[model samples]
Target chain A: MRFWILLQRDVLVAWRKKSNIYQPLVFQLLIVTMFPLGLGAGAQTLQKIAPAVVWILALISTLITLENIFKDDYEDGSLALYTLSGMSLPVAVIAKAAAHWLTTGLPVIIFAPVIAVLLHLPASAYGILMLSLLIATPIFSLLGTVGSALIMNLKNGGMLLSVLIMPLLAPVLIFGAGAVLETTLGNTPVGHITLLAGCFVLSLTLAPLAAAAAIKVNLE
Target chain B: MNKIVKFYHEMGSPPSFYRITGHWLKPLLILALLLTVYGLIDGLFFAPPDYQQGDSYRIMFVHVPAAWMSMFIYFIIGVSGIIAFVWRMKVAEAVMMASAPIGALFTALTLLTGMLWGKPMWGTYWDWDARMTSELILLFLYIGVMGIYSAYDDDPRKAARLAALVAIIGLINLPIIRYSVEWWTSIHQGASISIMGGNSGIKEWSMLRPLLVMALATKFYYLYSMLHRARSYLLRTEQNKSWVSKQFIEN
Candidate 1:
């Protein structure tokens, strides 16, 4: 009951702001547009690197809005209230990350095909690309929640948060991009997809607890 | 048994930890230095050159040990993190925070020496090989741990606890990262020397001995560095405590 209310409350709050929905999408489009401009719009080169380019862009754009996951709650004392409310903190963390994924990760997944077409990613790899993103981006939100909670109380924590989570995110990038690249080359992407899904499952079970512990430390 | 338990409890106290580690510091440093000098000499000059790669393979004396220490220190940090986070042991917190920079240093040394070794062996200073990529990621994990510790400057306790959580998370992820990188690709040679690999392991006693000695040397060096740093961390964080003040007067 509390989980749904918290999740609904977060979604409602994000919906009210509206920029929260569009900012990351715009940021994703702007950067996805840069690859063609900077890389000379060569279809061959763009297709070759498309999987990596798309995955990396997804990683960074999600990162840009990660702070908003916990920043407002931390500042307005809502996090403390949640802590004191005797509701489970990890449950709240999961709701917050799920809300973050709905607003941020889901848009990127939905909009990824446009980026894919722009990058000349082959029509063959499109489904796998979206599948990988579906698995990968939620892991990003889940892991990002832990990083965000850790530094939520600090000034200039944005860059530190990126540095903190980048190593953890590298495997996600490897498997996610590798899946699409394998598909582009006409190979079975079963292995890459399996590993990517494994990463998501691991983060799903463990990340909320870690994020809750970090939030408790910050509240202290 | 009673004495061991008593000593363990005493070591958890900050002042006792500082004093006990102080007593062992000089000997550990001396042992590390002596073993390092002996290992490098024997490995570089005394050990027969590798049949395939010749003397160039000698870089393993330094590279292999530093790589071992890099991973070993992280294991220690993770264990200390659990102790710190669960028990809130002050000594464990200091040890965990202090191990980060040392771990980072050894990790960097491993990468540097591996690159130098790779240039001759693999014809490239860098490769997206499995072991090397994982080592590079290990370096980043160390940097992240150190970064989180330094970020919360105003509150040492918060910093320690938060960094502890990060270390624990990294430790859990370490195997996943290693597996993913290994699955991605592998060009690095398989482990040449393993204690239990029997026939598949290093057969040449001359080469194996120096490598083992070098490994022992690095362990001593890590202990020396970790204790020295943890003492300073303890003194700084415990400055207001009466024991910390008394140490200055006694010294």
Candidate 2:
């Protein structure tokens, strides 16, 4: 119940503000639109590079919003309060990651298709692309929490966070982009997507505990 | 259990570690330098060049050892992180943090030599191939640990604790990342996980001898660097303590 309440509170807060939801979607769209102009209006080239361009933009969008995951709570001293409450820090961290996925990851997932269309991603890749993003965005949020918790006291967002988490994000990038590219190349894409799903499951199970520990050290 | 606890207590104290490692620093460096010479001379001159790529394959002596050190040091950092976290071993924390830059150095050397070797062999300086990409990511992981550790300059102990946790998390992910990179590359390029293993690859026993020698040399070098760096880290960390003052006077 406390977990759901915290999740609802985060989602509601993000929803009420609206920009926290829209900014990353807007960022994703802007980058996707730029690829056509930046790389010339050639659809073939656009189609060729679509998987990488789209996946990377999705990752950056996640980074854009990951800044606020714990910074706000940390700044207001609520992070300390959350830990002090009887709810338990790991559960609270899971709730926070869940809300982050809902607000940031969910929008990125929904906006992915439109961005895919804008980037001229192949029609066959569309489904696999959506599926890959659906699995990937939550992982980005979950892992991002660990980095965010570590640097919450420093007062900067994703600058250090990027360097801190880039290596961790590589496998996600490899699978998420690799899945789309596989489908675009007309392969089954089952393997790549399966690995992405596996990482998603793994991160879901372990990331919160790790992030909880990070937050504990930062607050202390 | 008592012996293990005793060993832990010995290393748990920074002054004791500083004293113990300080005594061997010169011998370790001399050993690392001697092995490096033997490996280089034996590999470069004594070993025959490859039948295919000729002399360029010799870069393996440097590249392979650096790569091994890169992965090996990260593993060391992870284990040390766990020890530091579980037992609050001060030396382990210092070792974990100090290992980062040295790991990054080895990773960079691996990448540089990889690029040089790639130019003649793979016909390009870069490919998104799994080994290279994962090696690059390993470099970033090293930087991440160092960056996070340094970010909390106001509180070194807390920084080490948090960085230790990161190292532990990263250790868990390292193998998974390596496997994923190999898998991803195979899917994209149809390349095998490693190109240097077994008989089908770079398998000349003559070449293998030097590679093994260099690998041994790099281990000593890592120990040399880790001991020196950890001593400095301990000194800086314990700078406020009277033991450090006594250490300088005694030295």
In terms of lDDT, the best-performing candidate is 1
Give the range of the ten consecutive residues with the poorest summed lDDT in model 2 chain A: A149-158
List the DockQ of the predictions in order: 0.84, 0.85
lDDT of 2 by residue, A106-185 (tens): 88888888888887888999888889999998899899888888778786646888987887898999988998998888
Please report, in order, the local distance difference test score of every candidate based on alpha carbons: 0.89, 0.87
User: What is the DockQ (computed on Cα atoms) for candidate 2?
Assistant: 0.85
Candidate 1: list runs displaced more than 4 Å: B186-201
For model 1 chain B, give the 10-residue run with minimal summed lDDT: B187-196
For candidate 1, the per-residue lDDT at A79 reads 74
lDDT value, candidate 2, whole model: 0.87
Kindly report which residue stretches of model 2 are placed more than 4 angstroms away from their true locations once superposed.
B1-8, B192-205
The 10-residue segment with the lowest total lDDT in model 1 chain A: A77-86
- Model 1 collision count: 0
Q: What is the lDDT, from 0 to 100, of the residue A24 in candidate 2?
A: 86
RMSD of each: 2.6, 2.0
